[model samples]
Target: MRTRPRGDAGQAFPIYIMMVAGLLFLALAFFAVGKASALRNDSQGAADAAALAAAQKARANFGLGFLNSLRANALDAFLIAPFAPPCAEAQRLANANEADTNSCTPTSGYLRDLITVAVEGRDPVDSPVLPGSEDKVAKAKATALIEFRCPNPKVIDADSNGYPEAFIFTCLSGDVVTIATADIERPGLWESVSRTLFDVRLVDQ
Candidate 1:
């Protein structure tokens, strides 16, 4: 039986170890990249939801305000709109999507009609794939917009003061109007004009 040199006995051991280490590193890198991507996607979803939520809230306010105008007809209440800060709605939506809101603000040049939101993923992952990256969290941003088109809104000028008091609306063909104090005394004289409300929705731009 021939005995190999002690030094050569394990010469291949180092190469094997190096190969294993390299493969392990590659795996870790892949895993880290995948984790980061997933977190990024989650963050993006959160941001989108948040922005949409804010826009939806504004839409609701717009509806209510227009309805009130149909009742009061004294002022264009929409000017004072956004009954609630859109950021609050965004925060709520971010939480639902397992993310925290980094920032929520209305887009410039758009009055309560557009919302933008930035968000971060909720939890930090302990990643061995990317050293020192474990502390980093995923972030994403989104924007949502709203617009309305009143095809043929009949502006109500009940007071004849040039300030519209209300708008007359009809879901299909029947007119719906709120009874005013004067309307109680004399029907159909001071009520809002019968017209179609604006078609409102979320827009990509």
Candidate 2:
């Protein structure tokens, strides 16, 4: 019978141990990457929801008879600034998604109809897949836009039908105009046309 030398004894055991350790390291790295990817997705989702909420509020703005261009009370919407309600809406939505809102800024593009939202996801301290992610936070940004399709108010008619078509107002300066219902040829059937408002869903940026 041949006996194994002392120096060579259990050498196979060390190699096996090393292989197992390497496998475990690879598995941990894969898990960490997966966890981080999931967190990043969550952050982006939260940002989108926040931005959409804010934009919806701004889209609700509208002006009624003799208000947009004519002088009237505050029961109307102003295109000059629509920041506060939308910002508050964004904050509420971000909180619901377990994210903290960093900023809600109104951006330039299409005049003042764009809103941008930034949020940070809560750190996953309890993550089993990525232990170190507890100290790392996920962040994302999104933009929501309001697109207006305004019908030319100057293209007036007696009613919905194009009758008594040509009408002009000296006081009106732009496409948006407000005039008395009596001024319309068919006062009883007259309808005021303003900027048609709608919102585009959030886009990750």
Candidate 3:
């Protein structure tokens, strides 16, 4: 109070600087978190899109009655390859690393090489609502696996479900329909980027 202002002025300056510095640090931390979140979302979206595209291709080829096994494998390979370049680019921007081959090994919970497609055929059967009338029905299931290395090596068995599943249906009127049922769960700070697509194709019998 008594002639203390002159001496305390310089001391106050340091306190002001410290406050400013703390604020700056907090701002930077928040910015970093936001940027990381955005990147994670982008990577996840890309993965889902790619998986769906590949599944559709597999369905189309199967409907045409093409080489089932080859088509399945080819479609998976084709779909996954395209994603590599884009995924790599995304990883770079996000400062993330690409998945290693060994990461997808059979022993690992992540998917490895082959894509699985399960086809189920249902013929027209008597509808419960329409006693005399018959209804057309068919169903197909397809699944694809994209393996990636986990950021935290300590984390094992990231996915308990094993693989994502897609369901497809076709009505007698040659109407194709598809539905996808895949749920993504994250543990700690890590999350799975899974893509699912439902596609249906009708053939002229």
Candidate 4:
């Protein structure tokens, strides 16, 4: 039996060890990057949900009594009118998604309202391969728009009381909702009608 040279075996062993170490380091680096990316995506989803929740909450809070007082043409102002920021809902939703709200702002536009939210992941990205990144948390931002879906809403003329008697909201989806002024007296009427008249969705920030 012939024996391999001891010097050659010593050299090859070191090379093999170096190669394995390099590969292991590369695998760990990739894993760290993937984890960071996943956390970022989760943060983004949380931000989106929070923003939409804030906008929807504002939409649901539209005062029916206020709407009843508006003129026929001015009724569309419901979306743009200044109202309380529904940031509490955003915070609640962000917490539910394992994130924290960084900021929540509401902006009013011509016929729409926008809720912008920023959030950070609850957990930090901790990886041995990424030095000083253990304290780094993922962050993301999102915007949600609340716009009226009814393009040509018809308002019935008011009676002697000068208050509009009814509203015929013809939504873009060909759905019609007729709301009598008297309906305002019923509880939960605005909550039910607002969903049909307004559309809440995520929009470009």
Best by TM-score: 4
TM-score, one value per model = 0.67, 0.66, 0.36, 0.90
lDDT of 3 by residue, 1-205 (tens): 5565687888899999999999987886666556445544444433333333443343333222212212232333333332221222222322222211111111113223223322222233333333442443232332344332211112122245532243233433344333232211112111111212222222111
lDDT of 4: 0.83
Rate residue 80 of model 4 by lDDT.
53
Separately for all candidates shown, the number of backbone clashes (residues 3 or more apart, or on different chains) is 8, 0, 1, 0
Worst 10 residues of 2 by lDDT: 66-75
Clashing pairs in 3: 48-195
lDDT of 3: 0.33
Task: Give lDDT tens digits, candidate 2, residues 44-86.
Answer: 9999999888887655533332243323222124444444446
Count of clashing pairs, candidate 4? 0
Kindly indicate the candidate among 1 and 2 with the higher lDDT: 1
Q: What's the best-to-worst order under TM-score?
A: 4, 1, 2, 3
Worst lDDT window (10 residues) for model 1?
Answer: 190-199
Each prediction's Cα lDDT score? 0.63, 0.63, 0.33, 0.83
| Model 1 residue 17 distance off true place after TM-score fit, in angstroms | 0.6
lDDT of 4 by residue, 102-205 (tens): 99998887567788999999888899988889899999999999887876667698778666778787888788988786676778777777787788999887
